[model samples]
Target: MSVVDVSGATTSRVAPFLQGLAREPIVWLIVLIFAVGALTSEYYLTALNLENLMRNVAVIGLLSLGMTVVLLTGRIDLSVAALMIFAVVVGVIVMTEIGPMLGGRWLVRGNTYAGPIIPVILVALATGTMVGAVNGIGIAYFKVPSFIMTLVSLTALRGFNYVLTNGHPYYLKAPLYGWIGDSKVAGIPVSFLIFLLVLLGLIAFVNGTVRGGRFYAIGGNEKAALYAGIKAQRYVVLAYVISGFCAAVAGIVFTARLKSVDAPLAAGYELTAIAIAVIGGTALAGGVGSPWRTLLGSVAFAAGLNLLAIWGIGNWYQNLAIGIVLIASVGLSRTSRKKTHS
Candidate 1:
């Protein structure tokens, strides 16, 4: 009886409970929202709506992929949406002028702006890569805070988008473009198929590839990584570039499917992507997450938002809900980390 301490008993009892709670907050949130969604709307669980929900999210979902890689290194890219608009506009212009020369014509839904599938894709991906290079150079070599650097680009890129569009939407009249967005493979949107392919590829890159593991190391401690002979700067730049390429890929799919290109196609999308990255358990401080969690996180986020839309929640209220969820998730993540540390 001389040294029996109540603290030891408390620690033993609380640790397991806290550990389980910490392990999967996003899963809990997803379950809770999904159940609520099912109860509120009769159409929530329908087959057609399910397809639409997944297809609609594919764009923002794509952005989340890039954001996942960037956040791992404790950086952010605010210009992603702008870059998307730029890519869409550029691709559409190239397609309309050159498509006829290469046996392309607007056929789907009475639109015809996409050129040859292969060339359109190459141009879009290249544009995205270039944008990422600019962003990376600003952050890595210039020693600029990612926030400031990306914001400047966002502002400037929006202007570029406006310059290209002249405030008008460009429609693609090609059957190919329409098919990319609306056609199905084994009964799934081809765009959705593209998303799955890209997501899976990225999952492998972030989880299995050597460069992926090194990204985490760069995020965790640049100095230590440098000491370990890791080319931290080069990899970091590559991350931004990859992120850009992802945005471009998504852009090509979106423009092709919609048969339309506009300056505002992806407005406010970066916020959604950033939110998904955080909710998926990626530490804002960097070095604590991956693509698997991000993939689920994107689904959870898009599903929840769609639930609100289906339930007839007002747009303003939807934004409020998003804000609330984001704040609460971050708070919960912080608490979980503290408990784990203690």
Candidate 2:
């Protein structure tokens, strides 16, 4: 073959591959993170370290998954992290105070308070859902901007968190908490398993349900969705509700892992969740992402942080890196979107 023909054939073959990678940067980002992590430290490649990494990122994973759903519906929830902390705090209080009335006894061992685990779990879920419902109602019914509404919630909840505990940490003791946070089945961390299960169910829900489609439609263009007879307001509310519920679940996992809850326990986690969703290829403008993508983003993000820690990078630098990555990802997404439209 002529030299030109050879070049043409190679270009044709490689073009599609490049396009595929562009369409799914999270995949390559994850590969890159793992590669960097393996090179940065001898311990990074160890089985135990990787397992710990997965377990630790489970909370962020859940939060990011929830953020992705909210982003899909063209909304945002800045209060999720605060809600997580607040919900867990409420749950623990319910277990410690309300449990006694319900015949649940507490045995203090050192600084940890032991009580019935059921009340904590139930109250946390309820607290999260209630907060989420309020957020939804304000945004959907009152037509409040999502950012403003959630920001207010974030502030209020954060203050309430401190009020509930008087700026101190509350340590709790429970077998189920330990199991959910630390135990493993067949060598897999239970926290990671829970994250995986939620990921799967969310995938089914967002991709398989009619309401899920409505979320996408509203996100893509609310006016058109409304014209099509889709209830945009209801779906938007549902999205925030889901976000709140996910935050609550994450709070449970986080409190379990630490065996404690504090005002600052999950401070700034909402930003991490947004970073995860955006890095996972979810468009901030909405209607262009999935749970599977968020999973890859979460893994990549966790791996990157692990690598940074192994390299002894400081928290300030890590935050800088997150900001850089978030901006770059959004830029790339917007560029790709423009190109597609053009």
- Top model by TM-score, which number? 2
TM-score of 2: 0.91
- Clash number for every model? 14, 0
Q: Stretches of candidate 1 above 4 Å error?
A: 1-23, 95-117
Stretches of candidate 2 above 4 Å error? 1-23, 103-111
User: Which 10-residue span in candidate 2 carries the lowest summed lDDT?
Assistant: 104-113
- Tell me the lDDT of model 1 at 104: 61
**Best-fitting candidate, scored by lDDT:** 2
lDDT for each residue of candidate 2 in 1-342, tens digit (9 for 90 to 100): 635688889999999987976777567777888887777678998988988898867989999998999999888999999999999888876667765677766736533568878778889999998899899999999999999999999999999999988888888777999899889999889989998989999999999988787878988888999999998888888888889989999999888899888898878889999999988888888888898889988988898888888899999999999889888888987887788679
- Candidate 2, pairs of clashing residues: none
